[model samples]
Target: MTSRKAEEIQHEGASGGWGSVSGMAKVLLREKPTPASLDTLLHQNKPHGFMCTSCAWGKPKHPHKFEFCENGAKSTLWELTSDRCTPDFFAAHTVTELLGWQDYDLEMQGRLTEPMRYDAATDKYLACTWDEAFTGIGATLRTLDPKSVIFYASGKSALEQSYLYGLTARFYGNNNLPDSSNMCHETTSVGLKQVIGSPVGTCVLEDFETCDVILYFGQNPGTNSPRFLHPLQEAVKRGCKILTFNPVREQGLVRFINPQNPMQMLSGHATELSHMYLQVRPGGDIAAMMGMCKHAFALDAARREGGEDGVFDRDFIAQHTSEFDDFAAKVHATTWHDIERESGLTRADLEAAADIYATAKNVIAVYGMGLTQHVHGTQSIGMLVNMLLLGGHIGRDGAGACPVRGHSNVQGQRTVGISEKPELVPLDVLARQFDFEPPRDKGMGTVETCEGILAGTVKGFISLGGNFVRAIPDQEVVETAWSAQAITVYIATKLNRSHLVHGKASYLLPCLARSEDDVQASGSQSVSMEDSFSHIHGSVGKRKPASEHLRSEVAIVAGIAKATLPPNPTWRWDEWTADYGKIRDLIEATYPDQFKDYNARMFDAGGFYRGNPARERDWKTETGKARFTTPTVLSAVGVGDAPGRYHLITMRSNDQFNTTIYGHSDRLRGLEGSRAVLLMNPQDIERDGLHVGDVVSLVGDAGDGAERSVGGLTVTAFNLPSGCVGGYYPEMNPLMPLWYHDVDSKTPAAKGVPVRISAGKKPT
Candidate 1:
């Protein structure tokens, strides 16, 4: 057996100590853990089905045997574990004591057994009945100005739960639904709605199979959506041309070994996924995409001058699109020099990518937060749509724009009106259905919500799920704003750091996990989830509840609504909570065209397909056609003063979710036991006079008077681009300044933060 470094060992020994460090070692390494126990555990199911709440990354449950990734398995184990956080347990510890524990240690304390109310006098959480909790919440809500309240939803929530939450909030006289989407994919929804009149992806999972070429930009599905690996592997095996453009050369993109495939698993064979990989700068995605489009347009022009037919989709452009000439002119006017400097890719590379696009008959472009978290996020997406429209790749089989979602059903949640700004149709239907005049005013989004909290305009917060404080940028400011609230309510399954940052009146209501059986008044119920491909699936939880006191999210919302609202003759909150299907019926009535016979459609096949505007080549724009959007050249924000200051791109390890770390192990990056290592290019290391394993401090030149130093980082040189560095997320989130965010999207540009890296002893 080979001796691995302390940083390279994933699993702890019996004494809970990591392995020792060795000499120079390879960077990319993987640990193949045995899955026999996981397979056995998944097979012996209890009732409905098992859903992992830890991460949005999931695979379709297969018959005969179900396969799971390491993180997925860890998530399942955590949910299925025997640990419990009972009321008596909380009585023994003060809020201050619990706040002192690490995030992992808090969750490791186990599942929240019951609803808890913060007792300020005792400085501890006391167990409360669900009815009591709801009554208290309702009283607090009823006293506050409705506009001062924010109903925040997370992606982990079910669509049915989200629908009820929306109704409850609107019925309470406000549409301030500040959800997780506002932080992650608000730009995607905003931009797509403007261009196509729909925010969801135009393609389905099946599209990946038939596409001749798939252009992936800014996402590593291996970590974010591990289930996408199977499709990519199958696509490559069939000779599909897969091209990738990312700041980092993702290990999952280069090669993928399907754990589901018995032969491959037995033989330890991995399939080559990406045929061509281009390393773009952190915020250079827009330029690279635009450059590709420019080259494609030039090619189309040349072919047309030579009297060639079918070079570009002229008929499609003329019939289904507007502003093509202007968009084309802007592309033509863009100088190659500017594109090269901005994108950090040469003209030759852009032409090569263009050549691939031109030759491939069926193409699909997939993007992730890498494209959406930048200042130019919206414009970047529009640019990709422009490229697809130019070649008429969209609205066709195996070709379209796929915005790979981070959380499961995040797209579905948005579809059901979990938005800060309510759509016209949903609002109208909501008003007609409930008989109350819906508020016409646009509500505050995530950024605006934080601003409102800071300005003392927002008074109360009711988050359905998510660790908002940890996930949001400028942690210090977000924490302060949260503390300023009069009341803060968190409806969650387990403990998190967010619970610690409580308000004057705080409540932690425990809810049944998605993988747990919910025997409500109506009967055993099921929730619907929409995947990246627009396929809606029915997920019924089969596991036992973590605790009998844990109420379903729907029930909790109904309880709150009943306590707060006066009895309305038109609506039945009690009846709806008794049965979720009735809520679906209301949803169908709201979007009759999309969800007609909602219950019947769900039982028809795997699930029902939501309306995909691009499938029929229909442009639902205000002009009844797709409009080409042209964005001006924008300058990138410099991180620090120095030129050689490395721009740090914060990313999640394979072993971690957004803010939850299952363990300190990143198999692909060859890091273990610790996540405080910074991956730098060898040239950068030599130029900066640093060596591997050297502890360093990253100093940010905080514009405002604040702490400017983050320390105790171990340096490791790898195959990264020069003047660039990579580190784990959440931990490195502190380095990102509060003001460092995309101008338009307000999304923290976590991928690109300019910092000065110095090698020496860790800061005291």
Candidate 2:
């Protein structure tokens, strides 16, 4: 055993000099310098090979020499690693033994080599052939009520695979398709459509260049979407004002260093990214936005009285919007005292922010999980749209709503019709094309899926690539619900905690990674994906497969479809798998307006932009124009008078992406060797009578009447607000109740979890 001093972890400015370079190098060192590793890194985000599986941010039209970020490199190396998990490896460990392993440890064991079937008697996963696994799954699905079966898609699945998955579900006469988007961006989809007549973003990547002001509300781009930093850094160089409003002062928002720029690396001086950083309280984004709009309305009134041009865009409002009168009246009625109490920012601070927006000619607004994972997430987005519409900072160059996506192909999945509602095109078109009437009934989303699991309505579950057990809220309840299923099928690449929480019958189908070569009867194939800005592009894998037994995601879906379907000519699973170009043909045929000449445009170096009418000044809304909504004023729900109660927010560490953990260290936040630390304000620590490194137990205060608690969490002082605390998720996910969700979108209130922290574990 080695003994040494506890090394203090140093937090640096986001991505510069040796920090980012060393971080990338460290991941490669652990996996050990493989030739394919370098090849995959060079081929990433290039026209010649596959896109980066890390993020959905668009790549430059011309492309860079190294078109990936530190996290991107980590994700690529993780997929291309030489390590393998064979059947022998599983034979040695029981399911009970593997249950004790950490999430990071499970993924680090490397790519799964073959298919597996759970044996409850031995509590072990035994080896099985692909045909046997598919036959069993098919037989089980044939017997169950189609409405009781649910299909789930992960964000990383290619559009070709997602299209087939959706088709298979519809062919089987159910639309129970719940995706990862239901967890992260469901609010963006539901809210944007309600306000702007579109579910996708209105701005492209290039808009970052010309926007004068960018309001980054409730988002941390530095760690979540690092490629966004390039555009932000360039925007700052051009004298654009970047404003941040979040509970914690994230280091990425404070300053950024460009590792690719040699002069900046040599100078060792980081560029200040944000003009102003307001540390709003947890669940305070809605209140802060409302305050800004109220102040802007006041500024407009005062300007008109002085006989000057007012900030209101009267021409644009008259020609392109509805419900302006009612929205304006609500803004006038909101009180300053309520805003200040909820937002944790003074009236003056809101006025200052309003002044910045009033002076700017063009502005862009971007947000992430902070705005979406709330009880009032849909209303929060409406408030954002109301403010932007006040000054006509939309439907023009460098001005629009941009809800930056966290996952690589989440946007792509939605674009290709991975939805609970399959009404992208009319039923007539789908019926004529596929010879089957698609299900018109509304289906389950992530939250509704949890409800289905608990109520015993959903008896069968099939996941394309996500760890559903860990990703969903209400950990204990979800585990029980998942175990109660008759059959559960997971098409995955590696071992996850979800595999351990199995049903009566479980099947683990291993698939090829995005960076690996996928060969079929039609030769090498490339999969298409849409970026956050709605640009659809093709990605071809260049590296060899990790295992000979591993198959492509498309092949697995096709095999299952072939085994299950009732033998119809129109449902040609084999033909679709023969050539993915044929899949593009079907997509284009179904939606001619959006996917015209899909195959031809797919190979274009810059990719093709899927048109957005909202960005082009086209209104397809109910009122034939953008609509302004008068959202209700909701105050921050305090922890009440309880001594140790606090507003707790769940967050992802810099080292992890979603539930996939790459390492134990979070370099950006200076956390290492552990992930169970709670970040709280020093003042809150004093008020609660706790010091650093004190183990505590946390219980939910949502009044759900269900017991929700997490224990063995160590307290750490952070620069958070007085009443706000932070904890890493999946670990803290148990504290979130299943019923605490937005009524409109069914997205869980992840960012607004109210918790009471106390020393020692709870009594049994």
Candidate number with greatest TM-score? 2
Give the residue spans of candidate 2 off by over 4 A: 1-12, 636-644, 761-764
The global C-alpha lDDT for each of the candidates, from Candidate 1 onward, is: 0.74, 0.84
Per-residue lDDT of candidate 1, residues 1-764 (tens digit):
11233223222111100111111011101112224324424632112344445334323434325444445555566655567878888888998898788777787677899899988999888988888888889899999999999998988787788988988888888879877777677777777777876676788766777999898988987667665777787898898988899877777787766665667656656687888889888778778888888888888888888888645789889988889989988988989998898788899998898888888878898888888776667787788888788878889889988888776677778778877676633787788788898777887777777778778888999989888878776676667667778899999888888888888899999998776677878888887766666666666776678787888999888888899998888778778878888888988888788787887766434345777876787877887887788977522343432565778888997667777766666666566777878888766776677767789988665456566556788887665666778888776766776666666657677777777776677333
Query: Candidate 1 has what TM-score?
Result: 0.90
For model 2, residues 1-764, the per-residue Cα lDDT tens digits are: 01111112224455545677887888998866478679888867877567988889887787778888888998899888888889998999998899899999999888999999999899899999999999999998998999999999999998899988988998888888889898888888888888888998899888998999999877777678887888999999999998788886777787888888888888878889999889888778878988888888888999999998898898999999999999988888889888888889998888898899889888899888888788788888888888788889889998999998878899888877788976653557878888787888888888888888888888999999988889888988888777888899999998999988887899999999888889989998989888899888889887888899999999999998888889988888888888999999988887798889999888677678889999987877788899998877544332332555677889887788889988877777777778988887776767667767788888888766778888888777777777888999888899988877776888777887888886874324
After best superposition, candidate 1 residue 678: deviation in angstroms?
Answer: 2.5
Model 1 Cα shift for residue 35 (angstroms): 14
lDDT for 49 (candidate 2): 65
Q: What are the clash counts of all predictions, listed in order?
A: 7, 0
Residue pairs in collision within model 2: none
Candidate 1 CA-lDDT value: 0.74
